[model samples]
Target: MPSTPAIVVTDLVVDRGKKPVLRSVSTEISAGTVTGLLGPSGSGKTTFIRSIVGTQKVKSGTVQVLGHPAGTKPLRRRVAYVTQDASIYRDLSVKANVAYFAALYGRSRHEAMQAIEGVGMGDHADKLAGNLSGGQKTRTSLACALVIEPEVLVLDEPTVGLDPVIREELWDRFRALAAGGATLLVSSHVMDEADRCDRLLLLRDGVFIADDTPADLRAATGTANLEAAFLHLIRALEGVN
Candidate 1:
């Protein structure tokens, strides 16, 4: 993997109505790798993602994507954000939704079809997005992001409600994207997904508690699994060790 950093954040501080969501958070995400942002449901994962994507306002900090400031016009085409909710037009066909985004990036219908198939949505390309299942909708949303071929892709709990089979399929696609040199930062509250990442950024209540690989986390905590390792960290942080 390349050693260059795709994203860099320093002292990022965000607040939601006087309550701090992320406090003095700073980290570097390596290029061409899958990095997992793991924490509990309210551990500021979404807030951090919004900061990187330039959607959420921060109280203090600097966020740079591919060397440019986050949310700048130049970075718009190079960075793609797939939200937790499906961002497709409910009334449009799956192919049409993907094609629409493709057109925005000056892509062709052929490329759009390729992106649709890349997410394993080829069979449902003609189906209305509103009529599809939850997993199918998520796939369509992913296809929309893939059509642009972004250099840095940020996903927020993409597999939240997916079954085992579909979740595995989506993760395989993520690995393929990373192998193709796209940097990915995926957020999840599920500790089991930690091993799927090349690196891990563990957060708890707006503070970073751990940043290491799955193996390193296990080794440091002397735990058999990531879930147990996470619990160990939490307990240590709370002075219960």
Candidate 2:
């Protein structure tokens, strides 16, 4: 028998006020691999992640984390979410911010320092979070999330506003995390980052139109790159009218 997925959804549907944001959507993410949620802006990537993280309640269907129903406090404690906006305390120093998050997760200051060093932010530990550049802030947020040693990590537009070098470094860390047996679900508009994932879920108009590896997607659409493949997929989906 096949193993249960680390993350699963069954006919999940979410409505925001008058309009529906997700329509009977279902997908699964397994452990030890990275799943990229690829979509254009306003395509419900954030909303979908939010739903799984318990920040948004669905109107219908069910979501399960590690085989349990969503929103259970125990399940939530094992999941970490990093939003597009920096969720750190801007007024605090990098070390202080990480220490505070660690405390929330029941870790000590020494454990927080270990996490900061592990993410390569030890040198800037004393710098104020708000004083750091965009990439630095991103790294700091990631460090805080890592301090909890979560089983599942959900990131939305993690590399936004980062330079190419820093983006590549971050991608390397993501690959390392997946290699070490963590389940990762990341949303990004950047094709380069999407290509690094083991699999991709293409989202358009608040629905998943394609779910496959980056190479498979490119081959299916006869496109040279992920961006072109996305364009082809969108055009084909629209042409179905």
Give me the candidate number with maximum lDDT.
Answer: 1
Per-residue accuracy of model 1 over 1-241 as CA lDDT, tens digit each: 5789999999999999999999999999999999999998899999999999999999999999999999999998999999999999999999999999999999999999999999999999999999999999999999999999999999999999999999999999999999999999999998889999999999999989998889999999999999999999999988996
lDDT of 2 by residue, 54-159 (tens): 7898888888887677668887568898888878999999999999999998989999998888777899999999999888999999999989988889999999
TM-score of each: 0.99, 0.94
Whole-model Cα lDDT of every candidate shown, in order: 0.96, 0.87
Which runs in model 2 stand beyond 4 Å of their true positions?
A: 1-4
User: All candidates: CA RMSD in angstroms?
Assistant: 0.7, 2.0
Q: Which segments of candidate 1 are over 4 A away from where they belong? A: none
Residue 207 in candidate 1, Cα distance off native in Å: 0.8
- State the weakest 10-residue window (summed lDDT) of model 2: 1-10
Residue 83 C-alpha lDDT in model 2: 88
Candidate 1: RMSD to truth: 0.7
